[model samples]
Target: MASGKYLSILALTGLITTASFAQKSDADYGWVLDSSKRSVKNMPQQNEFLNNQYPYPSKPRSMWELGVSGGGSFIFSDIDPKFGFGGGLSLRKSLGHIFSVRGSYNGSINKGADYRLRNTYDGINGPWNGNYLIYGNKYVANYRTKVHQLSVDFIASLNTPSIYRGNPKTNIYLLAGYSILGADVDVDAVGSNGQPYNYTGINFEGKRSDIKSALKDKWDGEYESNGSIRNESRDAIGRSDKNWLIRHGLDLGAGIAFRVTDRVNIGIEQKFTMPFDDNLDAVKIGSANDFISATQFRLNFNIGNSSKNVLPLWWLNPNNYVYNEVNTPKHMKIPTPVLPDADGDGVTDQFDMEPNTPAGAAVDSHGTSRDTDGDGVPDYKDKEPLTARDCFPVDADGVGKCPEPPCCTELREKMMAKPACAITSLPSVQFKTGSLSLSATAKAVLNSVAQQMNANPECKVKLTGYYKGSDKRSMQLGWDRVNTVIKYLVEQQGIGEGRLIFSLSDGGDPNTVDLMGTTEEGPNSIPAPFPNLQKSK
Candidate 1:
């Protein structure tokens, strides 16, 4: 049973490790600026001669996080929960920019008490009265459990930086883990004289607070009796050892940390643990399981040589690669632009295949002399450049042997006709009031518009949304509708985003959008007019 429980802990740790490395292959994360080349493992001076795309940068061996924490703990069982003392030591390593694995060892002294007296037939979580008859006819519920635990926690950072941001100084994260729990639990059943506690003077008719006070005044504080231990839970794990019982526990926690310096940080954390077995409070009342809650303040230290390792990845933004390359050319290869139009041909010499051409002669896009007719002469020298195929054989002066054919006139005319395309009768798309959602009818209308744009590839569209007053809300709603339509057309209907123009019309119905063909040019999209309003899609 112990082996099976340990295997689960291994599986969870392995899964997190595998996912972290998967991102290392693709992310543009921060690389340690190690000019010394200790991490290169190759010739140090070779990096100076490398091109923009040479050996890939290596991930720096980052520093591990070590922390110590001390705080109050409480136990939840059948009786009322009371404050206790707990502290722990943890070692953590980052798996990726967002995920990390932490291992912690902790110890706590937990205590709880029940004020109500109970009999054999009493409920509300009362142990068997006959079993503890050696103590007294009526007894109160209480225990003091000293626990030791070791756990493996996985943490996910919520605010790891990406594009448009730099590294973070404060981190918020959530965590969950698996733990092995062991505790020694005991109850105060006997008086200071080493005999069963006598309950003759205790008043049963007072308020719960008053009754607890009376019980405390009449008895010694030392727990002299052994707490009731669950026979089955212990025997299943291992042989009984002293007052300690062992069980598998699950932990959930969250915390925030602030960087104090390059080597240190401070944080406050809270953790709750459930050990599955209900014997934590030294009671087997068969009512509920027991759990522990701890809230601690931490002082953490970074353990590594700062020259070799970067701060943990969770503090690094992954967009520094793009941001750096745009502003500087330190690691970039930029070819000098080659723009020389030789022979006055209008095409660059690098791309022009023909080195020389007659002055003022018409040429194709490639800068070669144009041969309008299929005859062997260039247009600048040929007298006739539009000879029909039937008149193919021409003289040296480029005059066709025969006139244009009468029977081929209609065929030539038909070939000269352009493709028929018209963006007529396109439907307008409507949106829900004060929303970004498109209705079924609006989608059907937009689909028709996409088909027309696909047929007439040369056509651009203007999508205009209406607004009431000139107030910010009215204008922003119009802008939102136009933006939504353009996104739908480009994303869902496979239309090019550049083909849709956004517009807004004042003093009209705020829920309607109009689509029309446009020959005028404008920006395809625009920024929102009032951004503080809620947004939806």
Candidate 2:
């Protein structure tokens, strides 16, 4: 029993040791793009560099596995009763992905009793003294129970999920292999004489000897033996048989694991195994053949950091708990007309031709819009929006017009046709009824003429003084009047001398006489004065 316990301990230790060394191969990590930044300074631009962007992260650590277990097993198809409790430990390690090695130890107690007849000549019996006491009577015989298999195995673990799982964590699995089973078996039995049938054919009286000799080697100071009983009529003890046992088996199991911390993890698993070869039962009782079966529960403490190795499945991984597909060209979203700021310009780029203009850019009342040309007229309406020269143009009379280079002839014709100065001032200057000073108001008008001539620099006027006359004196007075206007225009008024043109006489059709004094008549007395001095181009 002590030895079996020791074997279990050794198997567990071996499993741990063996599994600790298992590692994932580089191939298992799949392909990961190298992401190191380029160290070279400035280099010539090349098409290759244009296509290259960023690199993928590298695989970080090695992959490893460990496990422990305990359970009961039953041995079958053996002559000796094959029923017992058993338990063991197993460990598996992956060595660089594709290949791995594993080792384990298992122990069991297979107990059963055996019975048979041993005919011995000169076998001791009750003394025949004083009545010829018959010798051998059938005696009951028995053997003490024994156990088997301190076992160990070394095998390769195959079909692992660690590779594809990406996570160094482990999951449910099945393991199968062979084991090297070793054990010591001692069989003990007691023997006794049999009774005779017909008065003297066999000894009827018997002395059964206690068979202590069957006690062979002891484990932890306890006798190790297989018990047996001989023919039903015998009562006696028998010698013990000693031999070696070998175990071969199949292991099947599943387990789950989680990272307790970075490199360490705790795992719990249950396992069942089928032994293919006989254990100590075969050596003790030659005809005994048995198969071992066991169930076990274990806690696996693992030590290994997570691997940075990328797997084919890495594309599906999410860094966070929430997951979804992420697309790039980050800002390309469906556009809305109301929010025309497609480029995210505060000033909707649609209305603002210069979308990216600096803030506080000169604009129309709608603050976001821009004025590309600085002209008072905004670019939107200004024909020659950029030039200050495109202002309103004034005609000769100092009145403004819309079109450029306003038609001076059309404006002059319109004003002249009105008879403002033509009929009124011209006729009035020819005072028919009086002297050069016709009336105080008329004098004032003449004075205004003088002031106008004085103010005008490059202007010229023609003056023809006229009157109603029947004699030369009136005619002469008209001349005197012309002289009076000329004197004011050229000398007193400072009008340029070359500009004044003097004329005399009626200045109108002489045949048309002035119907002077009456309100209804004159030399075509249109309103106040005689008609003359019309402006001509």
Candidate 3:
């Protein structure tokens, strides 16, 4: 009936906790969510290393588990085993998500008896035990063992959550370790008369339960006689002539725990203890070693200040923070995607090779007017698309135009002019507003310009830029653009300094620097009219 009340209290506690957690939202943690402000580092950047760019958060410091336990400890040896009471105290700590270690001290009193009476000289019973004393050779086996042990155990958690679950309420684990033990094995042999009880009247051939009942009536419950142990290394307690057998052993076990709150939990565990020596029941009658099995119920508490530390690692899910972040991010800084379609075309500026595509004009996915023929002209402007080739250059209306035949006088004039350059029309290089840096597309266009300039040494190139106002900043922007183009041709393209012209004029297209080749003489590098207006380099 008391168990029922305890179970009801546990259920009510969990229900209240779950309801309280369900009330929380992202806004509830607003007061405590800024990891940057709570950083342990001196500088902001050092703390920002794990902020929004990375998924990890600083690990919280936690404390060890302190436990108190009690249950039954049973022993198996030469005698028939019966349940005994046991209890212990332990401390545990986690090294990581999966492993932990525990230190424990425990003790128990276990008792057992044999129903079939036997002679001390029988081979199966070995030689007579000194615990019989004056009781002589005939005896019924009855014994009680006292044990105390200290052990260090390595524990492994079997249920570390790797998916998106809240902290687990139940933790299951397995453990294995070595133990140092001291046991006092004794026999309840002599009766109150100071002589072994007479066995002649007791039937050794009756049913097991009936024989056990008869043996009980003839015996005393006192376990005052000590069983013999190896004398060389054993220690006698107080003034008693009997000594405890020192033994080394192994403990193998598993357990499960249920969390009642952030600070407390309860667990059930069982351990099978195997001792190296066989003196646990007083007699070394058989070759098999003795064993003890302990089943325990543990109540554990976490020891630490609530404001400074978290619960033990085994109770916290490793994936909890990350899963919540992806679903409802609180600390992320993601920029909105900006897709500017300046010409009302169905494309963004970044991929639109043809800007300012006319409204109501049919265009391809690149925002360029489609052309059927392999000519350079768009279908919207081409009158004779198939006639558009190198020899048949198209006119403004896309009509084929024939070149005038070269006369003798024209040929003589060209020869006398010495070095006449034949260069094609070059494309304009566009820049982002207020940015002087050359983009990859701009650099590729200039590469073709350099190849053409290298082929025609006598050709002089003119670079022209435009600005809206006469203010120093506006004019300086235009000066920077024209000067930049001319420098690229002279310094980067290996063109002579005298072969390039820098021209800055009133508005045409503020973002464009037009390139054209001619024979005009000009200065290649122009001084910045307003150096103070220069933007970032």
Candidate 4:
């Protein structure tokens, strides 16, 4: 009855605990779902080094396990089959994820009787039947015994990368071991009051209802030997000497375990042990060897050094070691570093780019200054940095030499008319919405603009960027477009930076308009309506 109640509690507890764990969403335990997706590229080189030397690189340390279990034990012998209370304690250590070793001690007490032999002896009037009276009549042939066992087993786990790459909620294992067993046996007989000895009907072969009744009641008789029955002070084989009988045995078992928490687990195991000795019950009449079988429910606890990240060796995958060691070997060395200069401009060796430079000076990224146009004057003193190759000979101010007119008289007149030349608005350059990249058609148009600007060096152009949305992001995007256009003109066309101005329009066609004129009144050199639109840090 007690064993039945224990099974009931175990079933109910497992159901409730499993259901609670099932209710948790994947997001609640992100590590479990993400561990499988980890890649070699993201893992450190040290892990690869460690994996070559160890079975599981991620788990370098593990904890020992201590467990206690209780259940029913039964022995198959000459006597009738019956169950008795049994319990055990064990200590385990893992050698690897799939293999471990354990040492344990288990003890049990049980009773059994042969009704046919007892009935025959009771009916005999005088002579005793040798079959049932191998021992003196003072000791009945029916038996009861207490057994103590010590064993060491090698346990193997089957689950691997599929169900548990690391830690698992459930697992199963098989075990095989050698054991030493000691037994104390006694016999059941009729009492002085003329009643049959301590029979609780527990070992009787009967219907299910009769068995149920037997489990609920205690036996009325006691285990005795010739010495105890005859009221003599002599010692019997197993009754007086606790270590009188000892046997060597082999045990095989299988078990399933469930992790209830990081430090706790619940398991069920069944084992069958076969001993070489035939006198476990103090009777040598049976043809079959004596064997003991136990089915138990165990509660295990992780002892010293328990941590959530630690898992039983059986929960790890040894394949990880081979995979990492072969693929990401650490023999390769890291490369040396190189110097960096973020901006292309010369000068300012630090990583900063100076904006809105004064009139005329050419610089490269290395802080070196020079005049790109070799017009005999330094760029800092030159009025025009991009002096035409055809007009190389220049004055002190570095202005290119103008060609003499065919008619010397028209030279002064043409010079005066040059400043009076009227400048027309350049065709507007359009851009696609949300894009700063230049299209083939846009590039073609900008080529013409570059030519016009080169021809009219005195004239400056205003680049007005516009976008359709009023949000800050949209405004910043417009600002980026304006800057992109300016960068292309300065770098590709060799246009002087001083000749261009940038401005932003909050809401308009999503395009930039380039207006060429000498006047700076309309959007030229005007501050952007929005603050610097660079992204916030």
Best by lDDT: 1
Superposed by TM-score, candidate 4 places the C-alpha of residue 391 at a distance from the truth, in angstroms, of 25
Write the residue-wise lDDT of candidate 2 on 1-537 in tens digits.
323653674476457545633633222212222222221231222223333432223232333445555555444433334245655555555443333445766666654432222332133221111112233432222222233333233223233333233333333233445555554443322212221211222222332121211211111222222322222132222223443333455555544443444434554443444554333332223444454445445555443432432221211121211111122222223356464644332334455455553432333212232323334443233343223233344333323343443658776555435222211122134343543444433443444444333333334455655545555554555556665555654555466546565555565532211111111211210121322432111
Top candidate, metric TM-score: 3
The C-alpha TM-scores of every prediction are 0.53, 0.33, 0.56, 0.51
**What is the alpha-carbon lDDT for the whole of candidate 3?**
0.69
* Backbone clash numbers for all candidates listed: 0, 49, 0, 9
Using TM-score as the measure, name the better of candidate 2 and candidate 4: 4
CA RMSD of all predictions: 17.3, 34.3, 16.7, 12.0
Model 2, residue 511: displacement in angstroms?
Answer: 93
Better of 1 and 4 by lDDT: 1
Clashing pairs in 1: none
Task: List the candidate 3 regions with Cα displacement exceeding 4 Å.
Answer: 1-58, 121-136, 230-239, 331-356, 359-537
Model 2's alpha-carbon lDDT is 0.37
Candidate 4, position 484, lDDT: 76
Q: Regarding TM-score, does 1 or 3 come out ahead?
A: 3
Task: Give lDDT tens digits, candidate 3, residues 1-537.
Answer: 223533664576456445533432221222124343332552344255346544445555557999998987778777777668789999999876778899999999888878865556432322234434454566787778889989899998876555635667777788999899888777776778766667777778888888888888887878766654432344222114556677899999987787788788997787878986767876656688888878788999999765655567787767666666677875666688777878755556787788887764434545676553446676557665445265366667666664545667686445335346544356788888988887756765665566556656888778888888776787888888777766666677677777777888886788899888788877666788888887654
lDDT (Cα, tens digit) per residue for candidate 1, span 157-217: 8767656456666667889999998887777766777665666777778787887788778
Better of 2 and 3 by lDDT: 3
